[model samples]
Target chain A: MENNLKKVDIIFEDSDKCAPLKVLEKTLKRTADDIILDLIDSGLKGRGGAGFPTGLKWKFTRNETSDVKYVICNADEGEPGTFKDREILDRVPEKIFTGMAICGYVVGAKEGYIYLRGEYNFLLKGLLKKLSDFNAALKKLNVDFQIYFKSGSGAYVCGEESALFESMEGKRGEPRNKPPYPTVAGYNSKPTVINNVETLVYTTMICHMGPEKFKALGTSDSRGSKVFSVSGDTPIPGIYELELGMPLHDFVNEFGDGDTKAVQVGGASGHCVPRKKFNDTIIGFEGIPTGGSMMIFNSSRSMYNVLHDYLEFFAEESCGQCTPCRVGCQQLLKGIEAVKRGERPPAYLDDLKKLTGTMKIAAKCGLGQSVGNPFNSIIDNFREEIIY
Target chain B: MSTTEALVKELVEKNGRTRNSLMPVLQGIVQQEHFLSEEALICVAKELDLSAADVYGTASFYTFLDTVPRGKNIIRVCKTITCHMKGKDEVIKAISNALKIKVGETTHDNKFTLLSANCLGWCHKGPVMLINDEVFPELTPQKALEIVEEYAKK
Candidate 1:
């Protein structure tokens, strides 16, 4: 299984050979349907953890009739352990802009926006300069597409597409109801193609190397390699571009500090895979799909503290627009604390688990709904550690 | 015109006086002034044609869009799990001890305000802090103090 762990280089590949502008020009020669079909053939899902089919998302927005449409790059990389998007924005922003331009060409959008999180505001000045150059290049090519930057004030909920739209509209970053999804009514209440920054980069790569090349990498469900932000209890902690569908055991063996106890796949909202399940666990859509957050925990760390930290984070970051999320997060935090303080019996853990169940069903958005993933996995695997 | 009023008017002119311009307008004020004063909020509401409450509502929702008065420089130490794992507490303590201010406190001179923030997305290089827009990662307590001392002189 360790031998199967191969590092891939499609993401940070030198742009001299596969230049983004050249890829855009080559892609524009093809019809929009053809480009979308290539994306569909590539089987590239949204790299932002939701796993939505990227081609289908673009096709939906493209199909919608609208006077005004937008292509948005969701650069709000606020997932607790995820930092690949930041590296992407810092190193190769041209590729991201070009990807958005291609999306604009395909989706009939004249304007695009990158809703970057406020913490990464340091990158804004450099990004703006690069964007202006990209815009100039677009004008020279007679492409009527332009990209702009929108800074999100420190709100994690704004990472949600609809909440991002709300933030862009100068409102509170709250997730709107679905059905009128981003494709149908998004930023400024028009048809929009909103993609993760990494997802857009993959679209550009798919155009450069063709779908067959990308489709050859990972399993059918999760196609192409992904940029993983590896941190915590690891000897070499940093970003890695690895082929998907490898067993979790291989990842632990490669990145672990040798005394690894558990790995928190994805961010705080993602699942906690105990060491025993490493052989069975797959780091792809077929098993525990992550948005590229692989936080390895060694035996030295306490699962109790990790879970407590996560609950506290969720409690603070919840938008408070939905009661289920707002109150549920608070209660979970309290519930765990009470158990640890001996205010509640060990049996009380089961009741709190039920509360997370309610949160799973009742919470309005992914932030609240996914809290159960970490809560259940941690409590189920390390119940004694959480108790006393 | 008051500085706040002038700033608000200037931001509206730059970003456009629309409902969508509310965020950038507020962010502009915070960038310059460090926090949204009541006067700044009112000016923004008046310039953007909204109620003061409406403006404040949006501003207060974001952690970075500080409503209370902040110092000339804001020091946000990343307190998320990874940073916590990599000795953010020691870093925070060092900053607090050096500045004679705890987390969420402003210096008497209004030169610096120390606050612990959530993830700044530098997990690999943990124990990170942002002094305003500039991010400093992979800090020991000594390095954290040195960085703060350098900012204190400014």
Candidate 2:
């Protein structure tokens, strides 16, 4: 089974010669539309867990006729259980900058910003050194572009693109209303293309390797490789880059502890697949898509505790701008505690599920919309453990 | 002028007096003062031409920019699922016991403060804690307390 595993190291293929910068020079030779078309052919989706087509996002930003445009690399890796971006920023900071530069050239953006999370403030000095190196390289290549970094003040909601914009503008990191969308109006109301750190790195890869080779790695619906942050109960708990559409069972066979009971894909906002469903689950767009967090849980772990921890996180992390997300998170956390304490009947969970459903639809942004994912999944899968 | 007022003035001058420099200015204040004083917030608001409420709301919204004064050494223990599964509670308890204060409270000597953080992005090395800027991962209760003691002494 291990023999069939394919590992691609396009992002991590850094040499003394600076591979991504060389690729960016090659990519700059192509027309803007041609580069966007190459991305479309590659079929790469946003690695930010939303599965938005990368080419479509770029094309929209590229097509916007604006005097000012911005490219932002979302380095706010705040999602619990996800740490792949942190590694990328630490090891190959230049690759991310190169990717952002390429996006700027294609989208007609002259300025870019990387909104790095505050928890990673320690990485500021090293990343700044890399940025200066990248800027020097850009000057040498005669590219008229610049990159900047904004350190977030420890808000998880800032990971959202609009909130990131607000944070960068020196405001509370709250998400803005869509429809103008980031493509038409973003980052001081200019056309902005905000791509995830990993997504931009992958863009560099697609540009260097060509669409055909990148597409051939994963399934049709989900193309290219994904880097996963594996933790909990696994003998080897670290980052692993694998083909996008690999089955959950296969991943478990390779990384899970022998007594693995469930795997939480995509962090707290993601789903939990139990042992029985691992065979049917695939880690890609067609199955359970992830933002690169794969936390394995063994038999010794309590499902209720896992669910409780996630609820607590959501409750505290909710932006409190919307009532549904703010109140809904607290209620879900309290409701589960009530069930655990035998204060409420197990059937009362149905009402909480209905509340989560409301929060999913009624909340303004992704934070509120997706809280129901882990809430419903955990309640439905482990009713006995949660109630009894 | 008071130290708080002087610091605020310096930050405003360094980051510019525009409203768009609010967050960075606030972050700079917090970095220097460890917490944002009411005087500092008001001074920042006056310099940026914003209302005190605006400055307060923005300062309170973020987790790291504490409005209230905390201990000299802040220890943030990870409370996410990966750390929870890896017995993070024991580590939290260890720190709490060593400091003689619960989570969210400062010690009597004002030396250390213990708080639970959502995630420090060190899930792979579960059971992690961030002491100020440094990360200590894969911790046991003994190691966690020992580290706390080492900080408490300093």
Report DockQ per prediction, comma-separated. 0.95, 0.84
Question: After aligning candidate 1 to the native by TM-score, how far in Å is the CA of B113 from where it should be?
Answer: 0.6
Evaluated at residue B35, the lDDT of candidate 2 is 88
Specify the CAPRI tier of model 1. high
- Tell me the tens digit of each residue's lDDT in model 1 across A49-72: 999999999999999999899999
Per-model TM values vs. the true structure: 0.99, 0.97
Error of 2 at B82 (Å): 1.1
User: In model 1, which regions exceed 4 Å deviation?
Assistant: none
Q: For candidate 1, write residues B1-154 as lDDT tens digits.
A: 9888888899999999899999999999999999999999988888888999999999999999999999999999999999999999999998898889999999999999999998899999999999999999999999998988898788
Give the Å shift of residue A376 in candidate 1.
0.5
lDDT of 2 at A139: 87
